[model samples]
Target: MAIVTPLKTAAEQTLVQQFAEAKGELPGGPAVRKLREDAFAGFEAKGLPHRRLESWRYTDLRSLLREARPLADGAKETEAVTARLASLSLTGLRLVLIDGVFAPELSALDAIPEGVTVHSLADALVQPRDDLGRILSGPSVGADDAGLALNTALMRDGVFVEIAEGTELSQPIVIIALASAESERAVFSRSVVLAGKGAKGTVVEVSEAAGSAAQQVNGAIVFETGDESEIQHVRLLTRQQAASVEVQSLLVTVGASAKFDSFALVCNAGTVRQQHFVRFAGEHSEIGLRGVNLINKAQHSDVTLIVDHAVPHGTSRELYKTIAGGEATGVFQGKVVVRPHAQKTDGGMKSNALLLNEGATMFNKPELEIFADDVVCGHGATVAQIDGDQLFYLMARGLPRVQAEALVLQAFAGEAAEFIADEAVRELVMGEVEGWLHAREAAAEVSTV
Candidate 1:
């Protein structure tokens, strides 16, 4: 059979053109227009991503887009989704963005203390400041990053959060991206967060589909941290068999004695891809990167990251764990680079996977590129199955065979869940892990019998 070429729908074309036209009318006018035009030009040159692209080899966008078009605008307010917000059991300020557009009516922001500001990008763009423009167009030439360009051209609305200097938010701030009836259509969104000097806060980003509807979501997140400030970021994606793609870039300019910690969880989605870029340019800065992924059936999950050490006396550590079953595939590619002038750099990376079936697959590539003589860097990858002996021991202790299997699976995934700092969040993720294992074991038993 010959492969058929997919044509772009009229809606998609119109969406692209709308973005190109909006650039000219932006608040910043000509300068911002030039930046948007340049990015759009790059995107046009590259076209849509294909399987031939090395970075996108596992994700075939051409095939996925054959039937999808640019998502329609979402509803101004969705009460059904707003009612479900209580289920999150979260404490602190809650900001809602429905289908890429910021919805202040459905959000709860009373907890945000003084000295902090949270508003939509559309509002921020009108402010008489060039900083936002500068950061939005900071990507250099020859970057060859397709997702960033696509987002630049199609971003409808995003969140702009700024934590003032020396202000510390005691409670975590929750940003919820809710997809409702209107969002059942396709949507593209972006979010930017800035932590000012000597500021400290925690942010949790949650994305979920409202009902049993098919939709496409593409998103990007940009984080900027300043000197002596600390930021903890958590990202969670939960959708029911819906195709979603997310590209996250974290840019941290650490000041003396600063720290940054990040956690990413990709549990349920038709297709998910995440990229993390961390650059350390300050002395005595520390960064910790951690992620946990649980994939099943035809799901695909990929996590690619780059950690650059460009200064002296910096440290970074990354640990990623994946559980794959039922023909699922997981990919992890990590690179740590130490420049020649970066002395006293300490970096370590490890990727581990648990395969529940022979059909499941995992690809891990961990690398270190060092130019300095006084730096210490190391990386390792491991793939294995559940220990039969451990399962046997549990079964021998009077537990049923299925119960024993579930316990072993929990033990394997619990290692990564232990790192979650929030007790409530940790418990919620652990419960999900157990539920997945139970469902898998029951299915296996039915097939065998």
Candidate 2:
């Protein structure tokens, strides 16, 4: 008999040990112990993901994790945190997570819409409902990703939002996740949102870090929309300069005549990877996905998507654009599949990228698998540099070379930024892009002079 050596990575081992230790310290009874043990077992069965996993080939976490430690528990709740909150001017029912732990004192939950409930996932597990298990355990038709599995095993605390039938929320709900250290620790969080029949609402999720945080943060969000419902979701990721790894998964199911739209912005993270899986289970459902990423320095950002049309008369569209410079790397992979019975399916996907420097890199893969003879599905990808003619025109009109270059970069990025429906959110993302461009130009000037 041949002996088999365990192929677990160091980070996976460390997480397993930490979970075991934490499980013993919880104040719950036997049932809680069982739940903890079962979760750990699931984690052990599926270890760290590797390059063989198609979704994670370009963004490998096992090889990137040089050290591992437990994340600081409730270390971000301080008087100084108020100052940080004041700068953003966010107005909504806020749920704050400081260093991956919920901060009840900083959170504002009063005056929320009726028929809508928001609470921590740990708290929701104790409630009486079969929907959580049914929705979470469903089979994923997309790639078998390890980052998602790791997030499931190690997730500490995140939001759980559910809307009752026929409820319409006037104000958007905000979930804020903040990281405040540059340690070698890891943060794994999860968020789940479910909308009942005829329900309509909006959700805004934002992630930020204090400074250079050499940590790992993984997240997963599952949205379920019923018949005649609508949901608008926005996700923003802006981490620090140090090495960071994040995996965000969105699983959405649209019912008959339902509409779901989502916009994502990824800026300045060490290594950020996101996957979106949207399935149209009922006829006449509509869905749209838009994303913009601005990566600089040695950062890496990857966005992968899969849209499955299971029924007839379904339509879906996806557009993603990326801007990379200063040795940065970006990746976009999108796939649309239409079943044979799903006739009259209309789907289109486009991915474009701008590489500002020779060291910057981008990889785009758009694929379509159509079984229906009458379906209309198409995909396109483009990778190119700024137009020399445009640059020369701006420089000849009395604009400095650096300023002209910045304007051109902004225009290239603005194509995707203009898709943001919310005016405030669009302005915020544009400001971040401008800041990045200005910093790059300044660095270039100093190097040249």
Candidate 3:
């Protein structure tokens, strides 16, 4: 018999040890225990996904992550966190999580309205629900996905939200995740959102971190849009830094006649990856996924999506834009699947990138798989620099070269930013865009001087 040795990276070794040391203290009962064991076993088998996997070719975790930071001390509240949270200045129903643990002291937990039910993941783990397991490991997601599996095994705490049937919320639920300053810890968190039948609501997923030290954060959100319900979601990444790694995933299931809209903005210098898996379980559902990535100065950001149209009369649209400057790299990948029974399914995907400098990079892959002849599906991707003619046209109007470039980039990113329904949230994203534009302008001036 021949024995084979498995090659493992230092991060993988540390992760295996972390699982072993903390498995007993982690939340969830027997069921969750088994799930965690299985998930970790699977993750151990695969290790971290490498460039060999086409799905992860653009952003290879093995090479990108040389080692693992300490498992996050979820209980340790980072100092200056209050000041950091104050910067966003968010109001109206906020659920705050620090280092992946839900913090009632810092959140609007008491002010939640009557129509929605809010609970903590730790509380749920005390008596896990059968549905909670299903929500955590949905069919749309593969059990062996490294990032997700790690999150499943190690997730400490987060929020669970349930909107009652036919109850529309007056205030948008705001979720703020904060990373403590100078903590070299890896944080994993998970949340579930259920929009009951005929219910309507919006959830804002926001985050802030102290980039003084390197930190890794992995989080997941699962959404179930009930029949005829509507859901609006947006994810905003705060701060651009050179020393952070973020992997966030979203899984959504749209019920019959339900509408789902999601937007994500990536304007940070941190190495980040965002993934989405959306499924249409019922007929006549509509879903839209849009995002913008603004990265510069050697940052690497990736966005990947999979939209599965399993039934008939479903519609999905996706638009993603990227702005890469300096040595920054941006990636976008989208795949739409229309099953045989999914007749009358309509799916369209478009991705565009604007490279602002010679060293910038953008990678895009859009795919459509249609088994039903009655379905309409198409995909497109584009990459280009700012047009000289457009720059000239703007400069002719008394605008400086830097200002002209900002206008063009804003318009490029606006195609997706405009889809945000909440005016305040939309304005927040636009404001970030403006700040990024100003930063670029300042850098240009400094270089010339």
Assess every candidate by TM-score: 0.89, 0.91, 0.97
Q: Quote model 1's TM-score.
A: 0.89
lDDT of 3 by residue, 1-449 (tens): 99786799999999999999999998889998898998898889888888888778898988877989888756555557777777775566899888888988888878988888888887887674778778878645455478788889998889988899998877689998878747477889998898899998789998667536767888999898899998999999867357788899898988999999999988865899998988998999999999989999889989988898999999999999999999999999888988899999989999999998799999989988889999788999999999999999999999999999999998988889998888888888999999999988998999899
> By lDDT, highest first, what's the ranking?
3, 2, 1
Model 3 TM: 0.97
Query: 1-449, model 1: which lDDT tens digit per residue?
Result: 99764565543455467665555544334555565677677766666666788766766665566544545465455565767676777777788888778888777766677878898866766666667765664323215666667666666677888888888888777888877754346666677778888888888888877655656777777667778888888778765444554444444445567888888777877677787767775789888888888898878888877787878899998998899988888999888888899999999999999898899999998889999999888999999988889988998999987788788878777776687777776776787777777777788789889
TM-score of candidate 2 on Cα atoms, chains taken together: 0.91
Taken over the whole model, the C-alpha lDDT of each candidate is 0.74, 0.78, 0.86
Candidate closer to the true structure by lDDT (higher is better), 1 or 2: 2
Name the weakest run of 10 consecutive residues (lDDT summed) in model 1. Answer: 134-143
What candidate 2 gets wrong by more than 4 Å, as runs, is 1-6, 24-46
**Model 1: number of backbone collisions:** 1
Candidate 2 shows a clash count of 0
Q: After superposition, how far is residue 79 of candidate 2 from its true place, in Å?
A: 4.9
